[model samples]
Target chain A: MAITLTRTRRKKIHAIFVYLFLIVSSAATVLPLLWMISTSLKSGDIIFQIPPKWIPNDFHWENYYRAVTDIPFFLYLKNTVLITFFRVFAEVFMSAFVAYGFARFHFPGKNIWFLILLSTIMLPGEVTMIPVFLMFSELGWINTFKPLIVPAFFGGQAVFVFLLRQYFLTIPRELEEAALMDGASRFQIFYKIFLPLSKPALITIGIFSFQGSWNDLLGPLMYLNDSNKFTLQLGLAMFNGMTKVEWGPLMAASILVLLPTLIIFFAMQKYFVEGISVTGIKG
Target chain B: MKKLKKYEGFLFISPWILGFFIFTVFPISFAFYIGFTDWNSFTEPKFIGFDNYIHLFKDDNFLNSLKVTVVYAIFAIPLGIISSLTIAVIVNMKVKGIYFFRTALYLPAVVSGVSIALLWRWILDPDYGLINLILSYIGISGPNWLGDPSWVLPSYVMMAIWGAGGGMLTYLAGLQEISRSLYESAEIDGANGWVKFRHITLPMLTPVIFYNLVMGIIGAFRKFNDAYIIGGAGNQGQFYMVYLYENAFTYYKMGYATAMAWVLFLIILLLTLLVFKTSPLWVFYSGEVEGTKNKPNR
Candidate 1:
């Protein structure tokens, strides 16, 4: 009995240690973000004070106002929304359209085409960077939204197609056959049946596309030359430049830049986690 | 009717087929063509015949960028795998309120990249920054993180591991797939925790590790936003993409940039192929015969 008691006590101690370790690391993960928020609320003088304050005595909420005035926040916000909308729309609708063809049909060289699609998912953007840039430049599409938005119309991204294809495969074929028996066209069946059935998967890719285009900096930096056309990410970067320091407004702008994705992630947290797990397992 | 139905499939997929040709195949081949030329977006791309590639052999910035990128991959990939795996294992436990812990760790992953860099830049400030403040509490001074060349790569490594939680969900999914019977059997044999983890857990997780490893290489080579944001002091943090970006856009050396981009691609492809060639020896799945598991052709 005493020996069993000692083993239980040891196991209890082990559990306690595990919790301690987890809590500490979790604190480390979140402290910087918390500090960013804290700094955003502080006035300019206190930002450099020793032993930083987690909660400032006075929350200078005007820093957010200053952040906007420092750069054209709403203009950039409009640009970001425009880019994200078209990209996500293409990513959801076009990827689903193409994925339906792959998943439902058994055509010649289907397996080979599917393999080609898979390989493209693994292909990084660097390979096509320069030539694509040159293509846009030659077409005089640089400094316009066309370079960022047009290519997305065809297939959006290969990974989303792959995901939707996998999800579509799980849908029973009998449903489609029934639709066909009822004299539904292929496009009608696709639009009404497959797309509606895969709501969760569609939402998953929509969120992915939304998040990707929203936070993308390099694309806008490379393609968009006009300041009015800058995305929120590129605008947020303007807070700190070559010869100045503006920590408060910078942190405030960082918060603004972070808010959209944060809201999207938390609101659609379920789909986000599911998409990640599904991609991980399938990959 | 059958012929019409058969042709419908072709019509449905034609958009993607067209996209593949235009955005993918044409550009890759065009990049190859440009890599051998002296194109600068002004005059015609004069065919230079490997001169651009040969010039890169003597380019210091190219060599330094390659070295920085390789050094980063070496530290970031393995350390990232381990840190994320550790977080995954702990979160996989049956502890109470573990959901909160998972959320906290993953919050950074969802946060915007430039925002994260901005936040970290402040946190790592040598004076009056949160990290240095903590260091000073223990009577130690923190080095200037992005400002010092020697410390910049390590600072990036620290950032890489912080975002390691991004892969935690993947590892968690991988862990959930491990059979409970294996652990039960190991326990019956009087195997200790470390022994069971080493023998059973690590091997089972190798496939996920392999996936993350391949992704790690690709991501490390393509790392840009942070480097661009922080502006790696003394060129210490000038990753391949940053240098490539500057060459292509800033300097208008489109041909040289394309050559650099192709080299990066080849490096990634060769490394990936090398990993695949060796994966059969390590990555295992269930119900496999001896030495013939992943080797299909053999």
Candidate 2:
């Protein structure tokens, strides 16, 4: 009786410790973000105070107002939204299109071709990024969204194609063969059958694509020279550069820029967890 | 019919093939050529025949940046992976309110741009910055995070680890795949948590660890945006990619930049290959056990 009782008690203690560890680490994780929020709401004096006003007595909400009013917030938001929407649209659709080809077809050189596609992921963007920029420059596609958005239509990301291909391969050939028996074309099989069935994979791709393009800084920073064409990421960077050292409004704007990703993440948490596990990582 | 259908496959995958040519193949080949030239955007690339490659060794900035990147990766990779694994183990617990903990940790990873922006604001404020203020409360003063050359790499490492909770989910997926029966049997044998983790958990997680290690190395080597945005005290913050960016865009030294890029690519490839080569020794697969040759599945 004593041994059984102690063992159960030990289990209870273990549970409690687990909870404690979770609570402490979560706090550590949340602290930086909370600090950003706290500093954003603070007036300059409270912000500069050595002890730090974490929950500022003075709620200077005007920092948020100033952040929007002082900069081209709406313009930047629009530019980011447009570029992100198109990139995600093209990337998801085209990646799946190409993925279906690799998974279903047995064309001549298909193995070698797919191998080439996989090798592309091995080569870091830094290698080709310079040459790609030079190509765009020669084409006078600089200062536009062309450099950022166009290549996505051509299976721009090898990882996505690989991801979707893996998902497609899992589905039995018999599933698609039925549609083929009905005299449906290959495109029809992909569009009507494979795509609808692969909703989870497609949604995962969409979420990641949206996340990548929305948060992208380098692509926009490199290509878009015009202020009006600047994505929100570039705008935020510019806001920091232009302001020099204002933490209040900058933090506020940072919070604002972060909202979309946060919303998308919460809404589609399941797909995201699945996506990252499948892909290893975005880099 | 077989030949016709086989030819049709080309039509489906043509977009990428075309994209491969215009965006990838051409650029890669051109980049190789550009590495030997002296192009600066305004003029045609003049054949310099390995001058750029020779000059790379002479470029103090490139060497310094590479050293900084390698050093940053040394600290960031192990710490980042350990922290991520720790979080993954914690959150994998079937505790109540685990979802909330996972959400809290994972949310910051996706919040990329704003996090980068806020990292600067919170770290750079000498008196009011969160780090300094926290330090003062603890009876210690913080060094200037972005302004000090010595503190710059550490600052980036700190921020990268802060957002590493994003990696926990990948580890969770890996953990879930490990059959609970292994642990159940281990537990019945009177194995403790540490023993089960060391023997079963770590070995089972080798593939995921391998994946994360390779990806992490590549990422650390190419890490740019954060460093570029919060450029460290002086040029101390100039990472390899940042230096490459400056040479490529800012200076329009396309040839030199392309050469730097090819070198960076080789470094990444060689390192990745080295890890992969070493992986078989440490990375145990579930199916392939001791003294077996490399299996096709592996």
Candidate 3:
């Protein structure tokens, strides 16, 4: 009886330990974000108070208003939206077209081209940064969104193409064969058949592309010389001066910048989780 | 019919073909050409073969940046892998509110890089930071995390760990793919939890582990925005890529920067190949034979 009691006690301890681990790790993961929101709401004096208050006595709604007007936040938002929309649209369409080719068709140099496409995934972007910058400069495209938006149209993302290809491959060949037999051309087959089946993959790629372009800083920083052309990420980056940083405004702007992504993520959490799983399965 | 389909395939794929030629292939070739020539914004290009490469060998800042990058990668990757795997394993168990826990853990990942970096900078503030305040309660003083050079990389590492939720999610999926039968068999043999994990879970998770490792290495090398945001102008936390950027853009040492870029490329390529070669030995896939299939098209 004592042994059984001890065994039950041990199991309870194990369960408690697991719960404690989960709770602590979850807190550690979430604390910084909570702190950001907390600090953003606090007054300047309260921000620097020792034993750093987790909640503000009075929430400063003015900080958000000030952050927007202080910088060209609207312009940054406009640029980010435009860039993200067009870039993601282009990447999805182009990646689907390219991935279909690899998945369905047998063409000359197919293997070689496929290899080249995949090899780019392994090549660090830093390696091509200088030349790409120089190329854009020579074309007089610097300081414009052209450099940012143009490459995206041309099947620029290897990972997206790869993901789409894997998704396309999983689609039973019988569907395509049937479409072909029904006097459907390859384009029609792609559009009417494979395209419809690949919605999840398309959404996944769209979300990834949107998130990537919206959050990208280095590309804008490298190409755009004009402060007016700044994206949201670059605009937020400008808040950091040498010694002193405006923590309140920075956090405020950060909150503004982070909100859209978070909203999208939470709204589509299931799709995002499924998308990541699909990509990982292929990997 | 096959021949016609092949032509159609080429036509469909022409955008990528054109892109490869125009963007990737052309830019890479251009990068190679520029690496041998000295040209700032004002001056015309002057061919000076191997001079940029020669200078790179002697540059102390480049070497130090490399060291910093290596250190950052080492810490970030292992810590990311361990924490993510641990979280994944814990969450994999049939527990209540698993989805909520997963979403909470992944919330940081959806946070913007700039926002997170800014948040962490505040959190790591020596005087007023929450981290320091927490440390003080334990009678241990926290050093200047982002301010001090020694602590900056680790601070970044801590921030990276906070966002390990995506990696954790991937690992969770991998863990789910692992066969339950293996665990049951191990249990029947009187194996403890640790032994089952060591023998069964670890081996089965190797493929995902390999996947994450490759992704982590690539990510570590390309890490830029966080350092740029945190370090500001003077390159305090100037990582390797950040230094490369400064040289290329800030100083207009385009040739030297291109050389640095090439070296980084080669290092990444070598590392990727090394991982690929070594992966077959350890990465366990249940359905397919090891390495008989072609490389993944990605």
> Model 1, residue A125: displacement in angstroms?
1.7
Fnat for the candidates in order: 0.67, 0.69, 0.74
Q: Which CAPRI level is candidate 1? A: medium
DockQ of each: 0.67, 0.65, 0.69
Best by DockQ: 3
Task: Sort the candidates on TM-score, descending order.
Answer: 1, 2, 3
Candidate 1 per-residue lDDT, tens place, A1-283, comes to 9989998998898899889988888888888888899999999999988777789999999889998888999899889899889888987899999998998888898889889999998898898988888889889998899888999988768888888887888899999999999999999999999988877778777877887888888999899988888888888776666367778889999999889898988999887666655443232
lDDT string for model 3 (B189-275, tens) is: 999888999987887778778888988888888888888777732334788888998988889988888888898888788887898
Find the 10 residues in a row with the least total lDDT in model 1 chain A.
A274-283
Model 1 global lDDT (CA atoms, 0 to 1): 0.85
Instruction: Enumerate residue pairs that collide in model 3.
Output: none
Q: Rank the candidates by lDDT, best first.
A: 1, 2, 3
Per-residue lDDT tens digits of candidate 2, residues A1-283? 9999999999999898888878887887788888888878988777677666669887899999988877899999898898888899999999999998898887889999999998887778887788898888889999988888999998747888988898888788897778889899989999998888877778788888898899888898789988988888888888878746678888888889988988887888776666555543332
**Index of the highest-lDDT prediction:** 1
TM-score for all predictions? 0.96, 0.95, 0.94
lDDT of 1 by residue, B1-298 (tens): 9888887877777889999999999999999999998987898889999999999989999999999999999999999999999989888998899888988888766886678788888888888688888788799888988889999999999988888776787678778877787888889999977898898889877877888899999999999998888876789989989999999989998899999988998999999999999999999764463322242111
